[model samples]
Target: MYQADIAIVGAGMVGLALARSLKEADLSVILIDTTPIAKPLSEQPELRVSAFNAANKQVLEQLGVWQHLDQQRLSAYTQMQVWDQDSFGRIQFSSEEMGTSELGHIIENQSLVNALHHQVSQQPNVQMLPSTRIAKVLAGQSETMLMLDSDEVVSCRLLVGADGANSAIRKYANFPLTFKDYGHTAIVATIKTAAPHGKVARQVFTPTGPLALLPLSDPNLCSIVWSQNSQQADELLALSNSDFAKALQVAIEGDVGEIGVESARMHFPLTMRYARQWLSDGLVIIGDAAHTIHPLAGQGANLGLQDAFALADSLQKLAAEQAAFHQARQLRAFERARKSEAVKMIAAMESFKQLFGGSHPLKKLIRGVGMCTADAIPVIKQRFITQAMGW
Candidate 1:
C-alpha cells in the first residue's frame, strides 16, 4: 500500500505546479499519470503553444521552474493588434503603454510541462508514479483511495483531478459537468511569412470566426490559430499547402505579407467545459478537468496555472493552521475563489465569439466603434491591457 497527504491524478503543467508549490509544506504528495513525466523537446517548434501572461510567469517563477525553460524556444510579444474584417474598427495594444517591457511570452506547452516536471522531480515531498493508471477511485469520509492498474492501492487525505477535459477522476466522482460546443474547429499550424513578425500578435475577426497569428521565437515564423465553422474548417483543411497559404494571406489581409505553411496542420473541435461542483469531501478538480474556455484569447493555460496557484495556497493554509486536510470548508473555499474567475473568463470569451461571429449589421457597427473608441481612451485601453496581462 502507498500513501500520501494528497494524491494528484495527472502530471501536466497544472498538476506539477501544484506539487512544486507544496514542496515546502508539511505534506506528502503522490502524482500519478498514465504517460511518462518528461520528454525531450523537438528541434522544430511545437504546434501546441500557449500565451503565458505576466501573472502566469510570476507563478512559474515562484514555483522555481521558469528559470529552467529554454529561452530559445520562448517568444516575448510586446504588442497586440485586433481588428474586424467587416468594419474599420481596430485596436492595437503595446507593452509600452502599460509600462512593461513585454506583455507576455509565447511558449510551447510541452516546454513548460517539461520544466515543471524537472522541478517536481527535485522535490523531496513529492512522488511521481509514471505509466500508472487509476483503475478505480474509492472515496471515504476522510480520505480517498486510488486503485492503480498495477493493482496497488494508494490513499490520501485529498484527491485532485488535474487531468484534461475528459477527466476520469471527475467522471468516477460523478461530478456534474456542463459542456458547450462552439460549432467551430480550430486549425493550428506554423508558417513562414515574407515580413518579420516584429514580436507582435495579430488577430482578425472574420464572419466565420477569429484567426490569430502569434509571433514565435523565429522572427519570420508565426503560429496561426484559425477558428472557423466546421464546414469552413473542413474546406480549409482539404486545400493544398499552397492554396491554404494563399487563403490565409487573404484571411489576414496579408498583415504579415505573403505566407507559406511550414509545418503539418492540425485541427480540433472547440468546446467549453465546466464542472458544476469542483469539490466533494476529500476530492477536488482543477485545470481543464474543472473548466475549459475558447482559444480566442489564448487564456486557457493561463487560467489552469492560476488554478494551481490558488489550490496550492489553500492547501498550504490548511497545513499551516494544522487543520484537517480533507475539510470540506477549505476545499470549498478554493473552489469558490477559482470558479468565479473561471465563470467570468468563460462568459467573456463567449461574448467575444458572438460579437465577432455575428453577421448582424448593428453588431458590426458596435464592434467597429467599440474597438476605435476603446483605443482612443487611455483609461479604457489600460484596463483592457491590464486584464489581458492577467491582472
Candidate 2:
C-alpha cells in the first residue's frame, strides 16, 4: 500500500501543475498516469498544440517550468483577426491596444507535457507513477483509495481527477455529467504558408464552421484547426495533401497566400461536457475531468489550468490553517469558484458556436455586423482582449 497527502490521477498539464503546486507548499503528492512520459522533444514539432494565455503562462511561471520550455517551439501572437466569410464585416484585436506585448503563445502539447514532467522529476516531495492504470476508486470519510491494475492500493487524504474528458475517477466517484455533442469534427494540421504568419492568429467563420490558422514559432509555418460537419470533415480528410492545401487556401480566403500541407492531418469529434458536482468527500475533479467546452474559443486548456491553480491555491491556504487535507467545506468552495467560472466561459463559447454557425440570413448579418460593431467600439474590443488574456 502507498500513501500520500494527495494522489493526482492523470499526469497531463493540469495534473502535473497541481502536483508541482501542492509539492511546493510542502505537501506530499503522488502523480499517476497511464501514458509514459514522452521522450524529449525533437526538431520536428508535434501535431498537437495549445494556445497558452497570460494566466496559463503565469501558472507555469509560478511552477518554475516555463523557462524550461524549448524557446524555439514557442510562438507568441500579438494580434488576432476574426471575420465572417459570408459578409464583409471583420474584427481585429491587437495586444498593443491592451498595452501587452503578446496576446498568447502557441506551444506544442508534447513540449508542455515534457516541461511539466521535467519539473516533477526535480520535486522530491512528488512521486510519479507512470504507465500505471487505476482500476477502481473507493472514497471514504477520511481518505480515498485507488486500486491500480497491478493490484496495489494507493491511499490519500484527497484524490484529484485531472484525467481527460472521459475521466475514470469521475465515473468511479459517480460525478454526474451533462454532455452535448456539437455534431462537428475538428481537423488539425500543420502547414507552410507562402507568406509569414506575421505573429497573428486568424480565424474565419465559414458556412460550415470556423477555421483557425494559429501562428507557429516558425514564421512561415502555421497550425490550422478546421471544424466542419461530419460529411465535410470526411471529405476534407479524404482529399490528397495538395488538394487539401488548395481547399484550405480557398477556405481562409488566401489571407496568408498559398499554403502547403506540412504534416499529416488528424481530427476528433467536438463535444461540450460538464460535471454536475465537482467534489465528493475526499474526492474532487479538475481539468477536462470536470468540464469540457467547445474548441471554437480555444479556452478549454486555459480553463483547466485555471482550475488547477485555483484548487492548489485553496488547498495551500487551508493547509496553512491546519485544516483537514480533504475537508468537504473547503473542497466545495473550490468547486463553486471554478465551476461557476467554467460554466460562464463554456456558455459564452456555446453562444459563439451557435451564433456564427447558424444559417439564417438575419443571424449571419447580425454576426458580421456585431463583429464590426465590437471592433469599432474600443471599450468592447478591450474587454474582449482582456477576457481572452484570462483576466
Candidate 3:
C-alpha cells in the first residue's frame, strides 16, 4: 500500500496543476491516471489545442509550466468577431477596449499537458503514477484508500476526481448529476488558409449550430470547431479531406481565403452535465468530473483550470492557518467558493446554446437584439471581456 497526504485520481492538466500547487506548500501528493503520458511537449506533434485566458496563463506561470512552453508556438488573439447566419447581426470585440495587451493565447493541448507534467515531475513532494487504473475507492473515517488495477492500494487524507466526464470516483462517491444531450456533435480540426487570422477568433451562428475559427500560432493556420447535428457531422466526417475542406470553407463563410485541412478531423458528442454536489466527506471533484459545459465558447478548459486554482488556493489558506487539510469544513469552503462560479458558467453556456439553437421567430429576434445590445453597451462588453478572460 502506498500512503500519502493527498491522492489525485487524474493526471490531466487540472490534477497535475493542483498537485504542483499543493507540493509548493510542502504537502505530500500523489498523481494517478489511467492513461500513460504519451510524450514530452517538445517532442509531441500538435493533436488538440486549448485557448488559455489571461488568468489561466498566470496560473500556468505560477506552476512554472508556461516557462517550459515554446514562446513562438503561442498564439494571442486580440480581437473576436461573432455573427449569425441569414441575418445582419454581428458583434465584435477588441482587446484595446478592455485595456489589455491581448485577449487570450491559443496553445496546443498536448504541449500544455506535457508542460504541466514536466513541472510535476520536477517537484520532489509529488509522486506520479501513470497507466494505473483505480478499481475500487473506499472512504474511511479520516482517510480514503483507492485500490488500483495493479492490486496496489493508495491511502490518503483527501481524494480528488479529475478523471473527466464519466468519472469513476464520482460514481463511487454516489455524486448525482444532471445531464442534457444537445443532439449534436462537435467537429474539431486544423485548417490552413491563405489569409492571416489577424489575431481574431470568429464564431458564426447558423440554424444548426456555431462554426468557430480560433487563431493558431501560425498566422495562416487556424483551428475550427464546427457544431452540428449527428447526421450532418457524420456526413461531414465521412467526406474526403478535399471535400471536407471545401465544405468547411463555406460553412465558416470563407472569410479565410483558400482554406485546406491540415489534420485529421475528430468529432465528439455535445453535452451539458453538472454534478449535484462538488464535495463529500473525504472526496472532491474537479474539472469535467464536476461539470461539463458547452464548448461553443471555448471555456471548458478555462473553467476546469479555475476549479483547480480555487481548490489549491483554498487548501493553501487552511494549511496556512494550521488547520487539517481533510476536514469537511475546509473542503466545504473550497466547494462553496467555486460552486457559484461553476453554476453561473454552466447556466450561461446552456442559455447561449439554447438561444442559438432555437428556430422560433422570437428567438431569432432575440439573437439579433442581443448582439446589437451587447455591442452598444460598453459595460456589457467590459463584463463580457472580463468573464471571458476568467477575471
- Cα RMSD of all models vs. native, in order, equals 1.0, 1.2, 1.8
> What is candidate 3's CA lDDT for residue 143?
92
Q: Which of candidates 1 and 2 reaches a greater lDDT?
A: 1
Any idea how many clashes model 1 has?
A: 0
Candidate 1 segments whose C-alpha is farther than 4 A from its true place: none
Ranking by lDDT: 1, 2, 3
lDDT score at residue 376, model 1, on the 0-100 scale: 99
Tens-digit lDDT string for candidate 1 (1-391): 9999999999998899899889899999999999998989888889999999998898788778999999888999999999998579899999999889999999998899899998899999999999999888888888888999999999999999999899998998799998999999999999999999999999999999999999999999999999999999999999999999999999899788999999999999999999999988798899999998999999999999899988998899999999886777767878888999999999999999988996788988999999999999999999999999998
Output the number of the TM-score-best candidate. Answer: 1
Q: How would you encode candidate 2's per-residue C-alpha lDDT over 1-391 as one tens digit per residue?
A: 9999899999998998898777657578999999896567666667788888998898789778899898888999999999998687799999999898999999998898888888888888888899999887777789888899999999999998999899988888788899998889999999999999999999999889999999999999999899998889999999999999999989899899989999989999998899999887788899999998878878888999889989999999888878885977777878888999989988898888888885788988888789999999999998999999988
Q: Candidate 2: lDDT of 70?
A: 87
lDDT of each: 0.92, 0.89, 0.85
lDDT of 2 at 7: 95
- lDDT comparison, 1 vs 3, better candidate: 1
Clashing residue pairs in all predictions, respectively, total 0, 0, 0
